[model samples]
Target chain A: MKAKIGWTTNRLHSFAGITISLVALFCIPLLGSSYYDFLFSLALIYSMWALGYNFLLGYTGLLSFGHGAFFGLGAYTVAILVTKFSFKPFLPVIGIAVLATAFLGAVIGYLCVRYTEVYFALLTLAFSMFFYALVFKLYYWTGGSDGIGIRPPDLFGLRFSAIEYPAHYYYITLAFFLISVYIGWRIVNSPFGKALQAIRDNPLKAEAIGIPVRRYKWYAFIISTAYSGLAGALYAPLFGHVVPDLFHFLFAGEVLFATLLGGYTIFLGPIVGGIVFTVAKRYITAVTIYWPLVLGALLVAVTLFFPQGIVGTTYSLLRRKIGIKGGE
Target chain B: MLSGVIRPTHGKIYFMNKDITGLSPHKIVKMGVTRGFQLLCICSNLTTLDNVRIAILSHMGRIGRVFSPIDRDREAYEKALETLKTFGLDKKRNLLARDLPHGDKKLLDVAMAFALEPKLILLDEPTSGVSTSEKGKIMGTIEKVIREKGITALIVEHDMDVVFSYSDRILVMHEGRLIADGKPEEIKSDKKIESILLGVG
Candidate 1:
């Protein structure tokens, strides 16, 4: 048996990750213009969202087609707080948004966790669409299909809106992204995360051991929703608008696609995948309208050939080449 | 006393203080109870270590923060390894349970059950199809695990010799109704047990 504690390969990997992240943080601004900075921030935001989705789908082995509901709820909460209530400090607003979404997630997750696989996916999708319809019908609160326009707030009396710089907003987005990434990392590395993977692998055996599988799964779903909601909340300021499109199934599909592209086994895979996806969407949409078709084809190819996903497959190849075996 | 696998109706069972009477097989497993299937319920895709790890993880309190250290993971891994070692599976830890020979998989399944550390471990036909040479080793492992781990094990076995050898007490079920309960030697001499096994009672 491997020793419990040591300066193992995992430690080395963590060091490598930190070095790369620090280098990227310093280099991105130097090498690219403000436009690239903005796109990079957007990529980071989507990566967080996709990572959240991967938590439920990949780790817990539960498929949800309605996470857009949580995303939309977060966006709406932030929009309402900032636009109508005139909330100034971003932290409290973001906190309230996460809390509200977590509560919503708890309710939906309670209902959906009872089911598995396709049925669970369908249930979440139904609930999401139900909320979507409710938002559409409640025109006074939601502003109907047109969505509510949001203006960036002054952070501690420092007005980014007055400055009118994309770089300023990019920094704000980066802050949110980093925080969300850290929280997500903490969640996936926790003991709870291991239990969720066990549930995915063999739920029955999990229960027999005294782990409350349903409760754990419900908590997983809620956390995933809360994280996705945080992403949506950050998004309101990033785009300067909150729309019903945030709640659409298409948005959920995009996150799912990103998850598949990244591979859930490696923690950083989705982030890399999200960057690739955003760049592809940006460059492809500029030239062609049928971008979904192209993206769908690419996803199919990835699914068919690299089923373990880009990160998982690459990690396996690297491990084989390096003659490193077992968990890292 | 630990809860028995209570059958409230046909095609239904209640185990480990849960009303699993109408729950799906998987749901029943999720509820802190399970019956070892006739064919071992090991994941064919993963190694024996992975299988036991999954089983240990299934009973964890928090499923969301799985990658984080929870104080239980190390303990679980240690316990699982111990169970595997008890079953002589420590050497084959990296090998997939499915790829193992039938006898080894059976031993692995029992070890996997031990990894669950269940309050009541159910073993269905535990010694079935074992080679005569290996039956003693398998039975010895099962007996040792129950004693060492303090687990209440309920073994359902058709092999009369194996059953007679290890059971401190025996419960003979014929057509779902328990027909006898006594020490193994007492059960061996019972006319009812003989009649039931002969299909004439």
Candidate 2:
């Protein structure tokens, strides 16, 4: 038996890096303004969404172009429950949102997983567009394109005014984001995650080895969308409204962009990518009206050059600098 | 057709008294029929140990246990280790599948099938791309494991020596038609098989 190389020098380096970043994250609200707090929370929410996306795209090798539907589903579920039914507590709202999105994921993933590669991507986009149309046309329930506004949720009867709400919600989003990341880490390192990676690496081999590939993909899809739904549920309160645009393909593209920018192969890639993209998008748009053009050019350059992604490229360079060959 | 990667146009496949024709590859695998690919199709990005562990996880129905760490499951990890040792790949357990030589990759493929603990395994090419010297050793290891596990194997091989030595029965196909099926000695001596297989009468 091979001696378990449980924590090698490379893993240790990453662990240290993660620790420092986490510590810095804990200090962000104290050191920054309310605007910075708001932006950081938004980034954390997107990071949560991208983490789930990576499970499919990065780990399972399934490119879904309609995850916005799941995101919108969660936001809509929360909006309708709070507005229509006057659901006050945050826990049950998130719970219902997750379950509802999982159901949607099940239905969509059922049809979508039957196809792979571009076909799978297109199918997801179709479903997302379908949801966007539903939200846009059904003005009575969904409020059409105007969307539904949400009040800050009470936690066990503790409520805050508008001034205190963003910071309170910032902490909440940060907490959920950390929990989601930890859960995602546990998941990807588990036997389940390895099987997904195996399926990603070689579908033929995974199937021949008695893995129910479609079933696993379906499971991954549901899990991923569940996380996205959770992110949306949290996001609705933070943003003060849920809009039909949440279901738009453009939003899905941004999520995909974040995953790609972070390097989906690494566990922490999406988090870094989400934070960086949010910050960059905010700053770029402020500087010029041609922000989309600038973002598009940068994306093209990254895709053409740093294909492995920011985390992947940096790790490779670091390994090379130390004269260490890659791989276990 | 049997392993369900492809469907036969005209016939049904019966395994363990059930018809499994046109079933998906994974469904066929669940019915105790699995395969090793002609190409080295082990997960190249993962370690040799992880490659086998994936198969074991699938077999044990623990691939859905997302909350639990694989390392915490000592039985599964040990079983994967033992499977690798069975194929003489335990020493290279930490090495990624892409880094292993052709022969070891072939053995890892077979080892992956063994992890499934299937009743029947279809080996596409057990010794393809392996060096001449390493062929016998790899084949011997695979043959020994198959015997020990009491699993039936249907191997597709063009090497006459390997076919004659490793197989109890033989099958020959020409233009997708079964031209011959018999004991190795009978097929070896047959004029039709000799002309088709050896290119000589």
Candidate 3:
């Protein structure tokens, strides 16, 4: 009987998530104007990046401030591929971008995985700054502070560029976002996920039990970076441009905030947080240039009272109420 | 054979014949060495079964292979069940590790270490906070593992009775230095051991 309930609950959870995702994907194209559709695609892109960050922060309990380096590396791959090689197929370029970013992540993860908590974070941040400096100094390839622009190409065999519509780009972005979320879900449910969480709870205990905690961490970091790179690759085509800002500290902070605001525990939290952030930024920026002040105040309020973030707080409250009744 | 946790410096260690002197704690663990904390380190949100299952999964070939129910098949379940039964915790397998009593948490932590099947397992204060009656049970479990599995165990414990009961050999530390080493009976009667215990040496 209990097993039946567990099965039912699992089914319900999967069904609800799928339903919501489908609704959101379909509704965005219908409800929004062309400009809003563009903004929505950007939000999906950012959410993909934030989800990757959460894989490290939420699961492994390792806070990284250099995820932007991976994101920029991906964008740089796309820019370099398009400009230098005139890469015909988008799939191969994105694949290369993922591989390059994963390699970079492995190197950075190897160096920083030894540090604990705050030191790990600081090491990653230092790595990010190093990359940022390298990119800026080598102006010839990176195009320095000005950034580079690339025209969207035909996706696979489809004449996606021929349509040249925001809606078409929205669908592409949505497909990528869905795939990224699915991959993230797979990682989070796997034995690797269990090991990652074990490390987070207690690294020393985890190791003593014969878990190679450092190796698992490096794998997590590389996987997260690969997802971030995939997101950035999608962003390049969606925006028709790639900029140094993708590598900036502020951009990394934005991804962090998105992860927090959405609630790290729930897979959908980062996506919701990204959408909210993008919408809030758009609406608030139109109203006043001092939007950061307003957002900062809101963030402070959220932090102090709803420390678990929106989705997390709601889930806890619901669990308490229902769980108590169920126990009775 | 289990490698010794050789301290090269303060807060730094070498494990399994590797210079893990400045390596991250996680990296040190990945090299097949881990220490059980005095406090419970199980994921508070997960069940005892899940916690042990996580340990078993530490050696999994790939992260992508963990999703299927087949990943946690009869073998993994049996192993987890066996570990729990050995610790007298099979009945409470479904309970969250956090919901366990202090003594049980200590045992569960050790069980988690055991699940990893490490060549060398380090237990820091394993008998600390355990009741007198519970101490025997915990010690029995550790001894069973060492004897039956031939797994090397390094237990840094404060309970003289528990330590002396299970240890094949003993090393006494004073002011972070190895003060004495011999058979348990010899160490128990040594002047240096007495002085260290009585604070007279």
All candidates: DockQ: 0.37, 0.69, 0.36
Q: How much is A141 displaced in model 1, in angstroms?
A: 2.2
Candidate 2's residue-wise lDDT over A84-117, tens digit each? Answer: 8998798898989999999999998988887899
Off by over 4 Å in 3: A1-8, A161-164, A324-328, B1-35, B43-46, B59-74, B91-96, B117-122, B131-137, B140-154, B163-196, B199-201
Worst 10 residues of 3 chain A by lDDT: A1-10
The digit string of per-residue lDDT tens for model 3 on A136-159 reads 888899898888887776676775
What tens-digit string does per-residue lDDT give for candidate 1 at A157-224?
A: 76775125767667777777777777766665556665666677667655544456788899889889
- Predicted candidate 3 versus true structure: per-residue lDDT over B43-68, tens digit per residue: 76566886887766554433235455
List the candidate 1 regions with Cα displacement exceeding 4 Å. A1-7, A161-163, B1-7, B10-37, B42-84, B89-109, B115-120, B127-136, B148-151, B180-201
Arranged by DockQ with the best first, the candidates are 2, 1, 3
TM-score of 2: 0.93
DockQ of the two-chain complex in candidate 1: 0.37
Provide the TM-score of chain A alone for each candidate, in the order shown: 0.92, 0.95, 0.91
Alpha-carbon DockQ of candidate 3: 0.36
Q: What proportion of the true contacts does each candidate reproduce?
A: 0.43, 0.82, 0.48
Q: Which digits, one per residue and each the tens of the lDDT, describe model 1 over residues B63-181? A: 34444654446866776677677888888887756578888888877766666556667788887777888888878877887898687778777888888788889988878688889
Worst 10 residues of 1 chain B by lDDT: B1-10
